[model samples]
Target: MSRDEVLVSTDWAEQNLNTDGVVFAEVDEDTTAYDNGHIPGAVKLDWRNELQDHVRRDFVDRTGFSELLSAKGIGNDDTVILYGGNNNWFAAYAYWYFKLYGHSDVRLLDGGRKKWELDGRELTKEEPSRSATKYVAQEPDRSIRAFRDEVVDAIDNQNLVDVRSPDEFSGKLVAPAHLPQESAQRGGHIPSAINVPWSKAANEDGTFKSDDELRKIYGEAGLDDSKDTIAYCRIGERSSHTWFVLRELLGHSNVKNYDGSWTEYGSLVGVPIENPSEQQEA
Candidate 1:
């Protein structure tokens, strides 16, 4: 399909699961979910296995990313549909990873596995077939990602976003994972970040909120729809989902996800981390 022809409904995906040029991917951090069951014709891939390099705090190692995509029969031209057993949480993160790596013809399965299964869709236990394919890495859209240095500089004069829980943003609780190991050498947010949890873009069930509601929520957080915005979370996964919602769903013109997120930002040793709670209104 084309970039303009992105998202495919679960029904459309169900009908086209086995079609050529259509790649069905199951992205979950947990391998057991895929082992238990997955969409028919869907291939299982751990977020770390196919999406990120475990050793690298930021993203997939370039060479490893290429090899992983090729091993899964995913090529540059493939119209890939990604979903996860857990409400497409990891799938949305995978979608952003593919886009960052320059695969433009990719989309998330709306409502993901939970919705699909709730609608009585078909699932499979055995893995799907695969054929090797090649992908020529295209120049990445730097606007959708940020590195340590860039984030440090942006802290001085840019709209940084903390896509974590309000408590984390307030420094009330430390990160859940990456204990004692900071990804960005810092312990707080980029000096001026707005704390709007990535999950805020979606409802309790993982369905995204309406455009109007998104606008209101973001607006309330001091995010100008007309300005450039940078979002970050534990390790870029949650932030990527927010990036998608902001850039694609809300029609934001300039949005970037700091893929290094707090993990990379917090581990950088001297980068200042701001706790928004300290400045809360009386």
Candidate 2:
């Protein structure tokens, strides 16, 4: 299979649409996008509702996850191909969540829905109905995620990346003006974390850059395979996109997604925070 184990091209996805055991999913920040039009037969995974805990700032519990999968007609052994509208941001987060729960065969749709739509691939409003399945969730993998303490420990020792935009990194904005829900009490990145916006790794069309380009992009920014790397964004969605780029496309080992991200990091009192604008003024 020429397809990278973790990523599939648009051609691959289109060719496999009718393939047995392959389930296509669209994970989006905007719920209506899927209803508007999506890849034919692709089911919807709402980023806020399906993958998150209803009452907590964490992911769904194992039972909740299993139920969500079952409700989505996903068998534990089935192949899942995920894509999204917003440059694959939510799709990559979904990918990270599935990996944490040990879904063995999930793959990201390369370039995601942007590429699919830009290529003028057919979109359908019709929904697919698959038989409901009974899925058993695995124990969550802690190695792929980081909590506040782990991030505090990582300040000096690990490759901590802040994948939010420059404004967010500089404390000029807590979250984008449009997303008041993502705003944090604090607006700066973790102290000593380097700012590398998530979109830098992708082209204008949302496809990832070539491998050599990717190597130069991160390597120049002091990221490499040698150290364990942690990436974070406002609430970890954008950072998960960078996580996908580094861990899957670039083949870096020991990459973890700090899913709690800035939301958790910023709210903590007495934690070291960095504001580039402050440093510049000083």
Candidate 3:
């Protein structure tokens, strides 16, 4: 899909709220907003419970993913419009997952629910249902995802980016206030990983930056299509947003989201570590 097709504006979404072949889905970190109110005819997708594997610390497998989407009444040919809080953090993560599973026409709700509410758009507690259709799942695409072993190979190549906040990247902040001890045994970043906070890719209104500005941001960070790029945050949600920017917005060919991220890398034994804060005191 074209870059424009990757994001749908509020105006477009409002007009197409009940349009045929379009399904509006709200992806949230939790179920509060959805339980209270949501876009009419929209389904709620919980990022943690539904999308993740029950046993492993990874995404749900192909069979599980297909069943979940099938239950949501989403189909292969339907266009999915996703939105959520935290500046569309989990929404972007869901978008990445949809692409990973080979969903043909997934699009992010530009500005997300926050912007939707700010605009005073109508939200309903009413839930709508469509006939459940079988959603065919595709083989998990590894090109858009980076594993621990892949990250190890990319470390020395300057292809890994820590998209956490400066404090988190520097090991000054272990984790966010809402969730603690979920990161890892350590606070520092992976050795050789560059720090570029994920929020830099968005505007004050939560819309993405312009293509030129986005290219400049990544370009100034020494990233191009020359080698594979791996992006990570604490648990990979924010990095998925960055993944969207690099791949969907910038049109880079070799970008991957390191879903294992800091929680996986920071706690792992025998891995190299770097603490710029520690070095600064020396």
TM-score per candidate, chains pooled: 0.86, 0.95, 0.96
lDDT of each: 0.75, 0.88, 0.88
lDDT, model 1, position 103: 88
Ten contiguous residues with the weakest lDDT in model 1 = 177-186
Give the lowest summed-lDDT range of ten residues in model 3.
Answer: 174-183
Candidate 3 error regions (>4 Å): 280-282
Backbone clashes (count) for model 1: 16
Question: Compared with the true structure, what per-residue lDDT tens digits does model 3 show for residues 1-282?
Answer: 367889999899999998999999999978898989998999999998999987988889999999999999999999999999889999999999999999989999988998888889999999897888899989988779888988887887847888998988888787865566455888788887877898889987888888899888888976756878899998889999999988898887888998888889888889888987878877
Ranking by TM-score: 3, 2, 1
- Candidate number that wins on TM-score, 2 or 3: 3
**What's model 1's overall lDDT?**
0.75
- List residue ranges in candidate 2 displaced over 4 A: 1-3, 177-182, 279-282
C-alpha lDDT of residue 257 in model 1: 76
Number of clashes recorded per candidate:
16, 0, 0
Q: Candidate 1, residues 1-282: lDDT per residue as tens digits?
A: 222355677778878977999899889988888888888888777887656656755566667778888888788888988888545768878887777778878888877777787788777798887888886666666767777787778774777788887767776555744356433434556788888887778766566677789879888989865557788887777887788888878777677877767766666776676765655632
- Candidate 2 lDDT over residue span 1-282, tens digit each: 123888889999999999988999999977899999999999999988878888978889999999999999999999999999878999999999999998999999989999999999999999889888999989998888888898999997999999988888898888865676456677788877888899898899988888788888888887756889999998889999998888887777788999888888888889998877767777
